[model samples]
Target: STQNANETQAVVASVLGLSANKIACKVKRLGGGFGGKESRTIPLACITSIASYHTKRPVRCMLDRNEDMAISGQRNPFMGKWKVGLDENNKLVALDTELYLNAGWSSDLSVAVMERALGHIDNVYYIPNVRAVGRCCRTNIHSNTAFRGFGGPQANVIAETYMTEIAERIGMTQEQFREMNFYKEGQTTHFDQELKDWHLPKGYFQLKEKSNFDARKAAIEEFNKQSKWRKRGISLIPTKYGISFTALHLNQAGAMIHIYHDGSVLLSHGGVEMGQGLHTKMIQVCAEGLQIPLDMIHIVETSTDKVANASPTAASASSDMNGMAVKNACDQINERLEPYRAKGLPWKEIVHHAYFDRVNLSANGFYKVPDLGYKWGENKGQLFFYFTMGAAVSEVEVDLLTGSHTVIRSDVNMDLGRSINPSIDIGQIEGAFIQGMGWSTTEESLYFPNGRLFTQGPGNYKIPGFQCIPQEFNISFFEDVTHESVKTVYKSKGVGEPPLFLGTSVYFAIRNALWYARQE
Candidate 1:
């Protein structure tokens, strides 16, 4: 419990002039942070707790949406130029990019965030001489905050744009361009990260193939050959998202697993579940570890009192970290039961004796990823983990006269390592795709000059509704593929953020479709 939201403690800290060291804070599940809760939320809670302690009265202060939006942060509005050096074969040789991130009023977490952006600047491609220099421009805008992809989405979008530009310049198909440059085995990334032992390079490729990207491209080309009013475009993006806190040491998670006498199990981990099936995965993990039925386990909410010193569920590390922690705890209990199992005691009998003997049925487990290290300004960061690759082929119908773009069908092929829950996994892919679509085609941020956010109210800001959603959306995870070195037993990486970028591809595809329609 290091941070909180109460304002009273902050007021007291100001009045009594106490340092943060003199304060205690409590953290709970946040509905959504978009990176806002990473560190900044701590200060508010600390202030409130301090004030409550001093006032001897129940104290509470919550920010209204207007105040929340005005005072809180949104994704940094980045402006930059990107160029990729490619060989005649369309293989990417190098990338040069200059990024300007509007850091807003304070540094906050932008430095670390942008570092991750630069680290993942190439997304899933292999480019040797990649040079990406970023400047966190201090703008008067509300402190630019983090969203789902953090800086990864913005940074990767530029790469996708660069690919589109290259395809246009060479008259090669976008699919061809991507196929040529994707991070294949033995390919080293821009940050000098080596690509090794990929589970399903072909699995990702097959998704693109099954999605009929070539046919979609052909249809767009055919349409462009006839259209005159509007133009349509198609772009495919892949991700090899490294799952961890770049802070190395923060790449850890803790959990507590307890089995009651009645055979029901309680599970708590450091990662919070924000409707991402994190809790479901935890249940699966616990069940797998104990060789117990899934329904016998109850996954509990994340709390400091239960599993302390936990990391935020961001960076796509929730499953990797918490899964490991939970697995470790289960392994310990299994080890304790090994002696009884060796003596041919029934498993239930072992459990009964362990409880009767007052054996510690609860275990705290921890884990940190191994062999990942990085340094600043390195041409490549050695990747202990890789970017999970995916490609989307979207067809759209655009009304050129109205500047309205409608997606007809979308085919998403994503490298998800493995699908733990087929239905839940697809939902993650589909939901994120729609959300990302909103970010590109509909979601726009407006602000006032005095550093106030105008998107504070509902009417002023617009997010895509179902009416604007794509007509036919098809989402699939590359199932026959698996990553080898990944921590999970099934080699499944996080599916929460990568698929959001698919929505952007739909937007780009609509733009391409519009261009084609105009050519006709």
Candidate 2:
């Protein structure tokens, strides 16, 4: 629980040189983190604690928007050089890439981020010989920390950009090239982990059919031929994002559920909601597992006092890990009341009977993702429980004169593996896509030569706004899909981060439009 109060307590203890047990940290809910609050929150807390300790009074630290932007870490900016070898049919044969990440200042999470970039450089494709190297370059600016997709989005963009370039060189559609290189069921990644259940091909064709990709592509070509200043391009990109923390130890999560005498359930897990609807999904998991109504579950605030030593809610595995832990706790309670259930006892009656029988109404659950082992140096192991698959087709119109672009239409088909809550999952997908779009297009960070950030606020920097959204946005989930390796609660996969990679399609689509624009 990166957002847990304990994180602040630990920092405070370290700063004040006191025992951690003497410190107390409490948080109600985060306004919005998106990975910023994961580790960045600790410094402010520690500074305040130190000041209070010295002055013998309460102290607090707050940063204005400009100050915050100047000090806080942001998504890592990467410079990648890649060599891709393709066969006669434009299938990827071998790929060698070197990614240099601008890790401003200290190595906050740059090493882990670099590893993630190296791991994700393939981006749903299977190449017989692939090697990706990452270098973290230290600078005097603010350190770059985690964002939504971690480093996976940057890696996926690198791979997709090269793929798009290769497709253009070979006179093939990006969609065709992508489909041909999609990982099959038996294919192994460069890390030597065999893909157990691959759905990218099915998702690719499904999205193509649903989006009328071929027809729209032809129509765009015809329209581009007539238009002098504007050109439209369409591209379909696929993602097979491995789900789980690359570090095997971070794969575990814990939850505590307590059922009241009135049959009301109280659930708390290590995951911080962060406005991602994680608590809502956890409630749903408890309700589903305990066979109780949704309204009967009350989600308490995440506290370290309740659930200790929790992992950070990241890598898109928050729901998968926390939901399973909640389910496990609920299942334990249900198992204890099974005898009463077999007798057709009422829910409240069962709880009363269990109370009298000394059955535990409160239970703690712990879940560790199994069979995940990765040696960073060797770059080989079953690091992920399973890969979340998706495909997106984006049609964009580019202004050749200004090098500006607008996404005309976008279609997304993702496999969320029997979503726990379809609405929440869809929201996550849409939000991630838009955020990634901003990263690829409008969200540019600039710095002065002396290492001061010039884009310190919205006045100087641009982010995607309402106008940046696609005119026609269609998002759908693959039907009847579930994870083959991990037994997640409700058989659902993580939805937080995978769809961000889908935004790479928009970049390539704009690139395609630029190609036509350049010809004019």
Candidate 3:
């Protein structure tokens, strides 16, 4: 729904004659779009629509992997240069960064992606004086599109690289270097958004203790001193990902619910089910809102005809906005049924009476999350409603002879406030983390000098399969946590994209092992 509305606009413009009012774009739920489908889905639709209009028949366009690679884009490749001032103690004093993102063939979402990159280059650290400039550099290759973490991972990697290099310079562990500079309570981000509900420390310490990072670091040092061929390394990382879109208008969602005479419910929301369990959690939120059993509520696929001008299901804030919309719809119906309940009637009987008594059985609900803006000129505003805190420690063994590494173990700690559905949230965390791990570790993009991608298919490219996953993958959630800043449904935080950036722990761990191997 987020980009579907835009697709309609694109189609209308591409047709070169259709007025906006003459066309209606009805969209159903999409599958697993981590920002890729948001912008890339436009080109195919517009091209096909034009063909359909000329031919007077429905047109279908399908591109195989090679063809798709030839047209579509991958994550924008980034290059940055920076000047940093560190005090004698190696604490960061100021950071000035100028980033250039390869926009590829054209400027698609590269500018917006650059904005997110600039915002995240700080990566939760408290730098008193920081300045940044980002430019989208055009190239001859296919236009780069969005991937899972948007541009957060690329920027965070930059921050973490500096953190590690400084740590080594000062003879301190990466954890110590990072923790010493964390944004404490009552502090503010570079954008002047006052930091609140700080959970990074809470998760970082617990993850370190559980992962036994210090002991493992010591042991790895000793092992590397003896083993020349195989070197081991361990790294711990913390991340703070803000929820909501860079654009404020994309922060809202709508839901429509119907209560039948039999007390059954039909739920429709503008959230696409990309296998992150948005539908399942919405059902849970709906059932809990109406105080009904889960089986009593049914959700239909998201369609534009059902919810107009819906926001795209990116930003990891889908559940936040859609859940609130579902809650609003259920609340209205509950108010209508309150009288029947006071008469000591069952749910079905209440619905029967409410229907006959002329009480509205169907309600359309809408919600827009607050704190959706920031002022660049003044460097002030609530940029994020709340933070999704996470920390991870990954240990790896690198083969010095061949540039291959294996993740021995990974421990992750997340503070999701109170998860709507623990299982679904856990599944999201796992899936996002794994996908992110692939991006930083096994997934590499190669291109020929002529601007054509060489790794166009799986035969030439590689992705992390199950065999590459950490042998001891441990995940722990922060218990009894509640967000007091703003009441997001059930006090739950965003889960979809936050964990994706945490997977960089594996990359850094591999680097650490390689650093040891180089010494030998």
* Highest TM-score model number: 2
lDDT of 1 by residue, 1-520 (tens): 2222222234335656785345333344456554566655555555665677789877777877777777768777777688778776677888889988889988867876687788667776678787789989887877766677777777877777777778877998776777676677866666677666553357656766777777777777777667766566666666656656677767778989988887778998877666677888888988999888898898766665676657667777678778989999999999987776678776567778889987778899898777777776544444445565676767777767887877777878777666677777888788778878888887788876786777885577777787766687777766665467555546777777777776888777775775565444
Clash count for candidate 2 is 2
Q: Give the higher-lDDT candidate: 1 or 2.
A: 2
Backbone Cα, N, C clashes tallied per candidate: 44, 2, 3
Q: Where does candidate 1 have its weakest 10-residue lDDT segment?
A: 1-10
**lDDT score at residue 56, model 1, on the 0-100 scale:** 81
Each candidate structure's TM-score, on Cα atoms with residue i matched to residue i, is 0.90, 0.96, 0.95
Q: Each candidate's root-mean-square deviation in Å?
A: 3.4, 1.7, 2.0
Error of 1 at 379 (Å): 5.5
Off by over 4 Å in 2: 1-6, 54-58, 480-482
Of the pair 1 and 3, which is ahead by lDDT? 3
Q: What is the lDDT of candidate 3?
A: 0.83
